[model samples]
Target: MKFQVRCFNIILLVLLLILIYFFFYHLRYIDDDGEPIGTVYITETRGRLDKSILTDYVKDKEDEYFSAANISVPILVWWTPFTYDTGSYTRCNNNNQARCFISNIRKYRDNKQFSAFLFYGTSFRLYDLPLPRHDHEQWSLIHEESPKNNYAFSFESIMNMFNHTATFKRHSDLPLTTQWLASIDDLLDQTYLIDVKEKTQLQTTENLAPIIYIQSDCSTPSDRDLYVKELMKYIQVDSYGGCLHNKDLPENLRNPVETMEHDEILKLVSKYKFTLAFENAICTDYITEKFWRPLKVGTVPIVYGSDQFQDFLPDNHSAISMLDFTTPELLARFIHELNVNDTMYDSYRHFKLYQIISNDTLLARTMSERKWGIHNDRVRGNFIHQFECLVCERIHKTRQDPTIKYQAKFDDYGCPPPTTFDKNGEKLERSGNWYRSYEFTRCQLEVFHELLDQKNYSFTEKDINNAATKRFAPSFRRNEFLR
Candidate 1:
């Protein structure tokens, strides 16, 4: 009887202890059962909370925000370009997603829960993050520019931090594959079409060179100037602009940076038969106006940029590619042959003059299928506004159903490191590559961790300098990439 009584007391004590553990664990997580989604009591583990996150969190929240899985409206805050909304930001359909947009990060009169924090990848820096991440909040990336903007984005751990992305890759949450070109017509412009007969006459008279090579920024990752220098050995190249300037521009057009969009420059360049469309960095889907401008003004482009550049053009024969030749000499020989042969030259222009394209060209179909405009017609608004709606709709969908995961992958914005050429024709690492990228990121990530640990997003440049006095991690110290 004594043994039975002792067993009953032991079982009762076990039950009491189990109940006590759960009661304190429940207190650890401040529930928002009757408050706005972001409103919560701070946990002691995350260190001292940002006082602002506590005060302004649920400042203007309505009763509808309380205790609901499906948020009718989720606010998205832009991390960069604070205290402003202009251009495309003004034009949005709120009725569609029933969502809100906040240009500033902290202050909002209509303070709904901030479901996603958007970062413009080019403008975003290591010190520019919005910190003290909430359990319910997610991160979104709004950058369509090249990975040259921030090389650290190439790292898998950094990219996975973004829950969604509006990037150039076709698979991103919002694919802005060719946002630079407003429409298909941008590719089909024949405004400056010069007859082959006049073109050849101009070349012979030394009035217009056979090819035009204009680039201001020199010593680039592609080493464009180096290739152009080698190509000049065989062909007649009228080099203008800042790098390898062998000719003079008209007085007004001398400033290469400012003269980029001038009408006079376009008219002058159109007279040339071929344009050197060399990109600063070669990347996938990184085609810019360099390739587009030559095509726009009815000049043949010698494309030396993206590997899959033909996939974005009118036809396979639309442009002369650097990929076909072993060296610059071989490529220049092909150019010289085409320059002398009128029939061959005219053949390249046939598709443009006829206004007909092959069925396989994805350029037209992709442009027509896009939901947003390039500020060309304003039919559906610009890409910036469309990206906002994408975030808004995602927030609503994810809250409505928990199974949908918001994720952005490395391929969405990852760019391979830039390669430089030595005098020996061997590939060398430039400071813009993994060496600098890894070391710089190590320092930046230290500050990032400090920001998260202390809940201080406003860590200044001075703070970063002080914190990063110790450079290079022990794990990465022996790695050649960080050397």
Candidate 2:
């Protein structure tokens, strides 16, 4: 009886161990959406303050921040912009530097041996990723540009892959929100704003078209050219640049490249009553020079991009929303009405004309919240170097105490699905390989998880593509986006 009882206890112990393994290794692997975002290890701590001021803390007290004991010299790897530029990566040139930087993956083929991997969001292709992402090594996202890789990074499910971010999204660990503006002063500057009389005079004398749209990249995700072409039928537009060219730039500004560099571009654009400030891609806080140039030059912007664009506006009337109008013809009709009514048109420049921003939130955020500077900025340091330092310092902290870990939330890097309109221009289809790369990318994670368990699994681009194509793409429904 004693022998039988001992054997029964041993059997119970074995069953419990199996249950725990299945629960954690198999079941807990799923994210909230029930999708496996692949293998993960996270080692970074979020400061208990807003804006994750730990980045600013290290930057502010550099010497003091480095003196902590048992902090490992973490090697920070930049997976893209493969060239090592002068930007500070770890402790530069010091033998006991806080971190090291590398591009040659073969040198450290044991992928997770490094402490952190930073990916340049714009250039980092979905097809080409540093796979077998280990939770022990923190991942950092350095993308302040548009969602050109919407095929990969758009969905919230992908955010589970990274632990740090320096993007235009306000919720990012280090927000590069004001990338387009020269400074906060640029947004609030009234120094160059033309008065009502001057705008009227320029419109009459310069033969200024009601709206000016000068663009070089004709093909855009927004399909802006189609809208502009349709708008032209309803209103008189002086379209120049490469796309929809109906007018020539001034003799000196003939070279579009040179015109971009010329200070006169602002002066010339300001003469127009409105500027079509269409963006290349639509994503949150993806505002670029297209939006800023007009606002600064005193031209009312007909803006298209960013579903939450109004958050960046100085006032409700500061710019026209392309989304507001059902069709191009209707938008043109409103523009015509605004042109005739100087009171209505000039109201758009209220913030600029007065140099008084009623929107306190814009002032508060730009003045206080943002950590990175714009335009190779000298004071706050460029965002790239700052982001590298952020990864380095956080890795050190996490190494010293592994309990201090933080994961980037969905909002940190999430973008919506990219879609292209059909021939009817009414329906939207997903943008990707046969409009299916997004689906393929999600499926690729399963591949990553399987490959991750293997020792030193280095995937060729061809290997990844074939596996994802064969396993996933065929299952996707054709011509229709996955709902």
Clashing pairs in 1: none
Clashes of each: 0, 5
lDDT string, candidate 2, 1-483, tens digits: 999999999999999999997776654334223443222221111112232222332344335322221222455666654323212223422425455443322223243335777887766665566665565877788777776544456656567778899888888887776776656677776655776677778778887788999898876666677677878888998888889998887788877645653678888787888999888777788787788888887889999877777777777668998878877778989999998888998889888877766546553466566665665566665666677777777777787788998788888767665555433333255653323545677677666556655744677667767787877856765535454
- Score each candidate by Cα lDDT: 0.68, 0.67
- What tens digits encode model 1's per-residue C-alpha lDDT throughout 277-305? 98887777778778877777778899987
Assess candidate 2 and give its lDDT: 0.67
Best by lDDT: 1
What's each prediction's TM-score?
Answer: 0.75, 0.74
TM-score of 1: 0.75
